[model samples]
Target chain A: MSSLAAPLPATATTAASPASHEDRSSFAFLAIASLFFVISGIVALLVAGKLQMPTLLGNIAWLTYGRMRPLHVNGMLFGWLLAADMGLAFYLVPRLCGVKLWSEKLGMATMYLWVVIILGAVVEIPLGHNQGLEYAELPTWLDVLVVVAWLMFAANIFMTVANRKYEQMYVSLWYIMGAIIWTAFVYLVGNFATLFTTGVNQANLNWFYVHNAVGLIFTPLGLALGYYFIPKAAEAPLYSHRLSMIGFWSLAFVYVWTGAHHMLHGPISQWLQTVSILFSVMLMIPVWTLVYNFFATMKGQWHQLKDNVPIKFMMTGTIFYLLTCFQGPMHSLRSVNAIVSKTDWIVGHAHMAVLGAFSFFAVGGAYYAIPRMLKTRLHSQALANASFWLWLVGGLSFFVSLWIGGFLQGLQWNDPSIPFIDTVKFMKPFWSVRLIGGTFMFGGILLFFWNLLATWLHRSERPAETV
Target chain B: MIKKIDKNNILFVAAATGFFAIGGILTTFAPPLLDASWAKPAPGLQNYPELAKGGDAHADLVMKGRAIYVRDGCWYCHTQQTRTIEADTVRSGWRDVRSPVSTPDEFVFDKPHLFGTRRVGPDLSRAGGKYDKQWHATHFKDPRSLVPGSAMPPFPWIANNPAELDAMVAYIQSLGRAKDWRPTHDYEE
Candidate 1:
């Protein structure tokens, strides 16, 4: 009855007592891991700010700008975002499924194993042991560990679902399990494909990995969180189960075809580019569907956003997700891709989705589940508001500065009259502005850590109506 | 009356898995089925033949440079591909260079391709003949001293290690050499 192959019994969700005592140990571990990775990310950015300065740090091989850049990227991608996602998943999945974790030990092992691998990457990648591929920068050995870790995670989730007390599965569950399967295939192939591929084939595989990893893994999982938290906070059932089905199936159908949009105008086949662009445009269907579903569910409960931090974050995240999707398809067009292909606009576009949308969803999910796990109220709503505003201002400003800077760079580079050195000069002001934006982002993340830690440690405030 | 759906149905998971596999297979595997050449680069593709002819061409320097490039995340800022578009081919006036657009065959030997995701710096597809070795050495030591207002950081660390500096330069210089292979070779086609 507790394995993935167990037969389902036609039953109502009445046997809740057996599953109520879910494991909190993995949740606590993941939460702590997320906070530390975020701190490292902040440090990496601070070093990056210095590198952009006129007198960059001198002759420290390990701390060189080039080395720091990968550390910064990986520290954030694998370290901060992945850790946060896993932490929240470990917490939310059990509660939603109405079951205890099938194996808390396996969950903890995944968390610890992931942290260990990322730690190795932060050190090894900077020391020049990288695969020289974006997102796949971690060495081959570490990649193997990652594959093992995800298998363990999938096994735990499968078994837990097998023993669930409910007969009606939620949409979030569908998205989570689907993403787990999709990303495992995407990640393994992306990381391992290079060993067999050469030249343009390898290039194609790399983009496939990068684009699908985000689309299949983060996009679906992030949507799952929004699907779960938004409705719960609104005290409403989903607006339409029919819309969820449409969104999920269409997303599954189209997202994989859209990866080649990253290779538009490159040496890839013309047909590949055309197909990718078409699918990229079609992606609007799922994105808009989710947006509509989220907004409609919030019909009368918009007022909850004032006191409810999870709802506020979830609302902002869905809007940013909308923006990211719009920007993505438009930029994927060959004409538009030709202009912004190599610009900071691409970087800015990535941040809007990864940091602005998915990160917010992860934080919102943590706020909801963390206090519940600990049987407590949030430490401070004011502080939570402060954190949200700081990230909103910081994240938006960062995107703006990079977007304008990248556009200017694109125009200047095309005009051969302008020297490349001068183009770099023009971007100095924008880089400085980006540093300031990063500092605010760090401040916001720091505040989040303090709120969570304080709440976990001292149960001082009178518990409010559980959020 | 509502029907109770099997919330934990293995069949549902199986169906989702099938959809994911089909989508991936279509975009990734189907292309190679259409054009077999894409599955593998043409046999015996030459990469940097000039560098190979230099005899000291242990590939050691270029390999080291590629590793350094990866470590320092240089690919974040600089692209090696001269894409097949007017902006890249006709008047990519960056550094006052008029470079040819890259062909698909050029990347045949790249083990882990360096088609960079962003372009904070100018594309380096034609970088080899663009600058002198001294320019690279001096620039890496202190970028602002050479070109005022440039946002590139001085890698004084690499500047101190002469061997690593040479390796980095060699790799940068070898970029876009894939097109150079076509002028002299015979293709099976």
Candidate 2:
């Protein structure tokens, strides 16, 4: 069964292979980041479990719901998603271009800076040094770390692309390059614009920061990983290169304007809201285009998923991506927004995308990179399989429960006859389900980490024992 | 056709960033200039100017309480914006009459804007006068103490500090109150 170590892509056009010392160093970073992901995932789920029970630390300052909420979110966004994406890029970019990483030392530096900033946020946000923006909560002082880390990431990768031994850029290259540039712009502008603006003007900036963080940062990078992993795992050509281009450019054009939809029916102008809603609706085309393109590429290879762990993760990610995009545009409609805004409905949608869709991409992509970097098959196929099922079942449970709870909450909120606390009371049962689902999800993350550790240990070289 | 641009990633980066920049101007930069309502402040003097015309600004104690609210991250759970919708307006008359829909100007003085993203709890736009200091203190110390079904974490440890408790209640009391607020049209909680 362990003949599962797939051969390197036959299309090696690179002079410096992915297994070079430079790219291989990313195994350390990826391993560390995944460890952080599972750890923080457990903390986040623990907070969810305690929602109905007595507080975990009884409000010892940072353990309260307020502090834990941001810690959970930032932990997921930065510690898990962004950090892992960067790690994959470390392996993917070097291999795709057939060039040695521009600088492994610099990559390592970026990882450290990245972790420190996230750690600082994990501490600072809960301690009340927050910027008060959703998803962009790091105080400006801590935010500077992201800017520095991005520049380091950019300089290294842009230089690698420059020195590429290959002439043609693969699809992953375009996505990785674009994701890096756009995220820097979005994070910098989104975090800092509030300094110059006031009132809803600042709100315009805040929501822009919040939405684009997911759309620009997570979405493009996620697609990058999916593009690389799917063809490599399935041993098939992408359905249509032209279609991929269409999806890429259209996504770039459409995603930026969709942020203000979050501010709808609030104080934002009707025109702004209209533009957000319309652009969001327009997003459906590109959304379908990508989904169709991905599933088409999997034609005749669907059976590989049973034996291929990475493919399983990627396929699951794509399905959730489809669901997220569908729900996103539909909910942006004004009628839906009326009932859904400020309700648990938004939280449910967030889980569908953040935890369900894009995060699935990170998992699949990380698994793909780990074996390649370590020069071994995943240490335990059974553990990987277990992680997959647990994640799938837990994720689905989390989504269904929250969605029902949120929808009901919205209806009750809309109906003035039902007292508000009654709605809260009714949601308790659903919250209990969410807690159980969260536990399984957290358990799956732990199993994934354990598998990575086993893979690292399987390496005959004692990199672990020495260090 | 795609291969040419792939060779030169610099151009692709520029193109992508250019699109975002254009979007920024259209969506973020230009909208407020087009709509002046974003920063429009409420009418002068805080003691219900519509009724008597010489209301004072919100109390200093309330300002201190607002700081505590920010510190505790109450905005994470409780939203402050009540939309111009029928359900929100009617549900609020916590004290005497139906509450008024929230206005843009009610938030003009806010620096970071406390229009929260979620409502794990009820909207706090008109949380003032609905309960007194004792209620707020008790509620903060242990939310489930008041409502057994609350998702709120008990903060008795944090609330034990008198300054924290005092400031928090004061800030909550300041919600929905403005100098020129009309009793019938504005929040009276």
Query: In terms of lDDT, which candidate is strongest?
Result: 2
Which segments of model 1 are wrong by more than 4 Å?
A: A1-19, A47-51, A460-467, B1-8, B36-45, B48-58, B90-97, B180-189
For A1-467, candidate 1 gives per-residue lDDT tens digits of 02211221222332632334444544555465556656675665756476377365545666666566777777776777776777677666777778788887787677768768877886796587777777888888899998998898889878887787786778888788888889888997799976687667777778888898889998988988888888876788889877987898889888988878888888788898899999899999999999999999998888898888888899999999999999999998877887777788888888889888998998887777766655567788788889899988988888899889988887776665566777777877887777778778888888888887777655435343532
Model 2 RMSD in angstroms: 5.3
Q: How many angstroms is residue A286 displaced in model 2 relative to the true structure, after the best TM-score fit?
A: 2.2
TM-score of chain A of each: 0.92, 0.93
DockQ of 1: 0.54
**Ten residues in sequence with the least summed lDDT for candidate 2 chain A:** A1-10
Per-candidate DockQ vs. reference: 0.54, 0.56
Collision count for each candidate, in order? 4, 5
lDDT by residue for model 1 over B67-117, one digit each (tens)? Answer: 777777777777877787655754432243356776666666676777887
The docking category that best describes candidate 1 is medium
Reference-based lDDT, residue A276, model 1 = 90
